[model samples]
Target: MWSEIIGKFKGMPSQEKVVRLLLERGFQVDGQGHVVSGRIEIPHTQIAREVGVDRRVVDATTEMILKDDILKRVFMNIHSIASFKDVAPLLGLGVIIITPDNAQNIGILNDVTSVISMFNLSIRQAVTDDPFFTDEPKMTVITNDVIPGELVSELRKLKSVKSVTIQ
Candidate 1:
């Protein structure tokens, strides 16, 4: 919602990155959104370039997002973008979970489960609290779709799986 601030620094390099990063971090749509690093400062153009878009596009995106009644309500304060970093994927209309383990497992799980689960989902960090060392070895899974209980029951039948509990 920092569309005005973004518009003020329009045409600057990495403009998209600054606004996107800020929005991702949870800053609201307002002048206060400009106050990121303890001051009303604009980020360098490199940020926009890194995100592969110019500043104007980022500004426009911010404005469009701010106009939404839902977004305005969600980010009431022009807080730092850092707060919203965890919120974007949620906008994808799917459930998400954090495992804190290997990114690869999450990837594989997607391929395996996408067919069964009709919902669109994406994965990042492992959702398992301890993907590595648990009471026993553990694996984390993130999915937007619901898996059939029978599948889980079948997997637990494997010898390698000590126990199955959906965290």
Candidate 2:
């Protein structure tokens, strides 16, 4: 999937430079002077220095990448794919409401417990809607073992969450 997106940029005249930039900084800079970070959380300054472009240029590139939803999705998918190798062994999925005041805390707790459970089972799919903000979004998860009935029950206890459904 990552290769396919990168291939899309191959026809561009700046394809080589873009590839080089992406390889060096995990993202490519466009003419609009935007910058994007790669899977490993790249710093803006590092990207700018490597691409031989100013920090402002790198910043612009980041904005450009964000403006294009399709491109942004591709970048995220590529990033997720690249990082999958590291998390492949963890057979667990997570779900959390975004509106909860303790969303972050809940998310962290979910991740930790999920990791622990992954050792005992296999994760099928994990999906979340706006897992960061307080916007009352839904989260979904599917796993081999249901990730312990108690944990889901606990998350549903939060005041900010409207409800919890498990299938």
Candidate 3:
């Protein structure tokens, strides 16, 4: 569905760059065709710079999204999420990064979390990148305390996990 949504701007490569940036950052196109994060408007210049496109290209992309009902609905409701991956270690929290052999594999999150629970470690947050959007999607789990070596060993042993990094 995301591919189809983005494909809408297939003919316009500049607009496609804008759309990919918007989707990756969870930025939304408001009714007035403004790029926004919740109620806060993000300058079109910033968006344009991020995607290396002209400001007009960002404006046109939002305008196109607003014109389509499906795109408008999705973008209107989209908002950015705060990731704890950067701050976890500073806050003395455990950070576990699990790169799966295949992001499409189901139960990766459940399986990883189940193992963490077995060690009585509480999860602060679990976030996974969309496989379709990312070249290599990995799951980052922030736990209440530093992950034990035993847990890391166990996680690495999971059949679905390609690699496990404990921080």
In order of appearance, the predictions have TM-scores of 0.30, 0.30, 0.97
Highest lDDT model number: 3
Question: Which wins on lDDT, candidate 1 or candidate 3?
Answer: 3
Candidates 1 and 2 compared: the better one by lDDT is 2
Across 107-158, the per-residue lDDT of candidate 1 in tens digits comes to 5344334432433344333333323223333445544434445645654544
- Candidate 2: tens digits of C-alpha lDDT, residues 1-167: 44554555565434434444654334543334344343245566776576566666556545655576666664443322122322433544433222334443455436533543645655455545433222455545455553466756665565545565543
Candidate 3 residue spans exceeding 4 A from truth: none
On TM-score, who's better, 1 or 3? 3
* Candidate 1 accuracy as TM-score: 0.30
Q: Residue 53, candidate 1: how far off, in angstroms?
A: 0.7
Question: For residues 58-98, could you state the per-residue lDDT of candidate 3 as single tens digits?
Answer: 88888889888899998998878999999999999999999
Give the residue spans of candidate 2 off by over 4 A: 1-20, 23-40, 80-167
lDDT by candidate, in order shown = 0.44, 0.48, 0.91
Clashes of 3: 0
The ten-residue window of minimal lDDT in model 3 covers 28-37
Taking all chains together, the TM-score of candidate 2 against the true structure is 0.30
lDDT (C-alpha) at residue 110 in model 3? 85
